[model samples]
Target: MTNEQVIRSFFETVRSGKDPDQAPHYMANEVLAHQINGENRVTVHRTPQNYADHVREMIDAFGTFQLTVEEVISQDPKVYVRWQQRGTHIGEYEGYAPTGKEIIELASAVYRLEECKIVEYWIQIDRLGILEQLKRNQM
Candidate 1:
């Protein structure tokens, strides 16, 4: 499959909550993830196992989640995706107890592919907006 198709399938897998098991098939063994939000930034050297663990955590925190892909663009080894995610907070997340609130958030991701496997990625999400909604529901 093309890089664009690979990314699209990856998102679909994530939307189906099957990311933990399928990540290895789409991502390279030595994947790099850069996540930036305003003044905070984190980088992770991700392997299939570690990526699966992350996906499991997300699934636990956000129950019944759905990711809507707004746009997808690819040029050779690079792919970009604009997406919106909606889910219900059914479990603890980032130390916040379950608020049972539905959240809608936007995010963008850029992926670099090598030999049809995603090798590197950068992701930015509406963290502040999600926190606000969770806080509001708690009050």
Candidate 2:
């Protein structure tokens, strides 16, 4: 699979509302890296394990989240995508209860592919804005 194909498949899976499995097969293992925070605009370099944990956390929190690709730019080993993600806060997340609120957020991811697999991924999203929309912030 080419890098473009890998990135496409990843987005397709998420959009299909399937459980966030098949991640290991979608990403490279050796130097598989990721960055996932509000300020994560670039890959901070990490292992596949980090992304794995992230996926699990998201799944556990949202139960059923959807990531819609607004636009995608693909190259041999690099794919950049802009997306919108929305889900209901139906489970515990970061010590917050399921507010039963649906929140939508803008996000992006940059993937570095190696040998037809994603070796690195960097993600950014407006998390604070999301929290505010959910009305879970006491401050």
Candidate 3:
């Protein structure tokens, strides 16, 4: 798939509040995404099912989070994405009750694709923004 197509599908899957299964057309069955930005951490999932819990966690916390792609520059198998994430805290998040706060964060993700399927992604987003909205000063 072209870089544009792959990125488009990512947003669609999350926005639809659906599982990766909904977009098998975009993955290699063993898709891997790395949390390199928001979490400032790196983890890899070998299979789509491997990320089921994380997916639920994300959709649950943000409660309608959307990754809006702003700029994308690709050079085969690798693409850098500049995006904004917007969502509302509507449920239990970080062991806290629904704060009913909406958060917007700027972020970037470097996607690694194999055979047109995104095998891995390195993402970064502003966690402090959400924390501030929750009225908890971040360290």
Candidate 4:
């Protein structure tokens, strides 16, 4: 599969709220993920198994979710994706208890692929907006 296709399938698997059965096919043995939220930033290097576990944790936190791909642009080893994610806050996130509020968040990611496997990625999402929604629901 192409890099774009791999990304689409990866998101689709996460959106389905099921354990990813094909994750190993799309992700490299070692992947570097850079995530930033508000003033906090984190970077994790994960094996395919570790990444799968991380994805599962996210799915569990978000509950049922949908990812709408707004754009996918690819040039050789680099691919960029812009997407919007909609879901209900049904599980704990970042030390905040679930508020059962619906959220719509936009995010973009850049991925570097080698031999159709994703090796590195940088992802940024609307973290502040999501937190605001959760805080509003708490009141």
Best-performing candidate as measured by lDDT: 1
Q: Rank the candidates by lDDT, best first.
A: 1, 4, 2, 3
Model 1, 37: alpha-carbon shift in Å?
A: 2.0
Our model 3 lands, by Cα RMSD against the true structure, at: 3.4
What C-alpha lDDT do the candidate models reach, one value each?
0.86, 0.69, 0.68, 0.79
CA deviation > 4 Å runs, candidate 3: 15-20, 37-40, 136-139
The residue-level lDDT of candidate 4 at 72 comes to: 88
* lDDT tens per residue, model 4, 20-130: 656787788888988965688889897778777776776677776777889989887888989887778788887778888787888898999998888998889988887
Provide the TM-score for each candidate, comma-separated: 0.94, 0.77, 0.76, 0.87
For candidate 3, the clash count comes to: 3
- Model 1: per-residue Cα lDDT over 1-139, one tens digit each: 9999999998888535765688889888888899986797888899877887877777788886887899999998999999988888989987799988897888998999999999999999998998898888888
lDDT of 3 by residue, 1-139 (tens): 5876776676667423566454455556776667765435667765655455566776787776776778888887788888887778777776667766776778787878777777777777676766676665222
| Arranged by TM-score, best first | 1, 4, 2, 3
lDDT, residue 16, model 4: 44
Candidate No. with top TM-score: 1
Q: Model 1, residue 131: what's the lDDT?
A: 88
* CA lDDT for candidate 2: 0.69
Better of 3 and 4 by TM-score: 4
- Evaluated at residue 56, the lDDT of candidate 2 is 68
